[model samples]
Target: MPYALYYWPTIQGRGEFVRLALEEAGVPYDDVARGPEPDGGVPAMLALIDGDSVPHPPFAPPFLRAGRLLIGQTATILLFLGDRHGLAPKTESGRLWVHQIQLTLADLVVEAHDTHHPIASSLYYEDQKPEAARRAESFRNERIPKFLGWCETVLERSGGPWLGGRRVTYADLSLFQAVEGLRFAFPKTMKRQERKSPRVVALRDAVAARPRIAAYLASERRIPFNQMGIFRHYPELDP
Candidate 1:
């Protein structure tokens, strides 16, 4: 049976992380929400969240329904897929480390999203422009370097072109998404910091060059980054 992935049809968001892992592994899966409604579109995704058909329900979108199992949360889903698809290390300690890195990346994702939605997700970016400006300043000047620097350190420690030493892992894919999103949302900031994180930038480029990933990226299956997604581009916030 094909794996069923449920996420918003428009934006990549957190689901992109899971999608990257599946694509990199050459795993076959259905992007449920993107299909027609009769098949499994937005309604089907909402049903999974609201319906009582399953014993376990996800609190949000970007959940995966695999056979009899329903899994939620981006990091948890990646951990499950990583182990199953060989996107993570075989050893327990190594798996845990990859999960740890994924969770940290998740944190960074939230922070990046919050830069544009600093006041509240409910409020429009225009309504909270002042607050967002303040938030973006700190994020651009301090947080970006801190997170990217840490990733560079990890790559240096691994002594690799990939995050999991010699092998590519879900963590590497997630980092690639992060770099892409950051570049879209804060091109100026990322361009300035890219010099400091050569290994991290190289890893992003390396992931992009992978055959499956490269194809996925070029294909229509991979959604383009837009303002509605976690990483939104606003000229003022980035400046």
Candidate 2:
């Protein structure tokens, strides 16, 4: 059976990270929530989150249903995909290292989202422009460089390309997504930051050039970055 992934249909959100792993692995899977509601949609996704029949209830969207197993959280889903699809190192230590990098990337994702919604998720960006401006300033001036520089350091210390070195892992794919989101939301900041972190940029470029990833990116299935998503581009926030 094809794996069924549950996430918000309209936005990539956290689900894109899981989707990247599935796509890069060349596996057949149903983007459940994106399908018609009668079969798969937000209602179907909510069944796993709020339904009484599910043995393992996920806290939110972006969970995966693989046969009898119900997996939640982006990191956990990616970990499963990495191991199952040879996207992670074979050695335990190497796998842990990549997982660690993924968690760090997750941290960066949260910070990026907060740049626009620093006050509350329920509040609109307009409601917290003042706080967001302050938060985004710090993120642009310090956080972006710190995160990108740290990623560069990790890759440089590794044996070769990829976080685990030589072989591409799910973490590498995720790092690419993170970089892309940052570039979309903070183009000016990233243009400056990329100069200081060429390796990270190179890795992002490399991931984009992968046959499967490239194909998926060009397809309609790939959602365009919009203001509604986690990575929103506000001229004021970015400036």
Candidate 3:
């Protein structure tokens, strides 16, 4: 059976990470919320999180269903999908390294989300604007460089275009998503770091060039980064 991806409908959110990988690998997947019915979009997603179905439920959006396996956590789901779809390296060590990069990317993602909502996830950005300002400053000065530097190190150590070296993997997909998110959220910061992270940028461009990825990005299914998603484009937040 084909995999089923459960995620919020409107925003790309964490689910986009999984979507990018699937699209890149040309794997078949059904984005459940994108189906028919009222509230089948966001409300269905909310219900799954609120319901008692999976014994090991996800703490947030972007879970996957593959036969007997029900996997949550964006990184975990990607790792599984990558391996199953031949997008991952064959060696155990290589797979471990890929997972490491994915987890680090996940951390960067969380920080990016917090840049626009530093105080509480439940609260509106308007209510947390002051805190968001402070967090965004920290993100621009500290977090962005730190994360970019680590990715630079990974690229340097890997010795080329992809995170796992030579071949594209889940790590590269996640990193592409990270770069896209950061570009959406911190265009100025990304511009400054782009020169310093050539390998990272090359990988991003490579992922973007893949036929499936290129097509998906151009398609309407790909949501534009907005103020509501993890990567919010606030003019004041840039640079």
Cα lDDT tens digits, model 2, 51-86, are 888888999878998888899999999999999999
Query: lDDT for each of the candidates?
Result: 0.93, 0.92, 0.85
- Per-candidate total of colliding backbone pairs: 0, 0, 0
Candidate 3 vs. true structure, TM-score: 0.94
lDDT of 1 by residue, 12-114 (tens): 9999999999999898999999999887799989998899777899989799988888999999899889988999999988898888999999999999999
* Residue 209 accuracy (lDDT) in model 3: 93
Question: In model 2, how large is the Cα lDDT of residue 174?
Answer: 96
lDDT of 2: 0.92
Q: Which model is ahead, 2 or 3, in terms of lDDT?
A: 2
| Runs of candidate 1 exceeding 4 Å displacement | none
> How much lDDT does candidate 1 score?
0.93
Query: On residues 139-222, what C-alpha lDDT tens digit does candidate 3 reach at each position?
Result: 988988888889989899988878889998988878888899899888998899898888789889999998999999999879
User: Per-candidate TM vs. native?
Assistant: 0.98, 0.98, 0.94
> Model 2, residue 101: what's the lDDT?
97
lDDT of 2 at 228: 85
> What is the alpha-carbon lDDT of model 3 when measured against the actual structure?
0.85
For model 2, which pairs clash? Answer: none
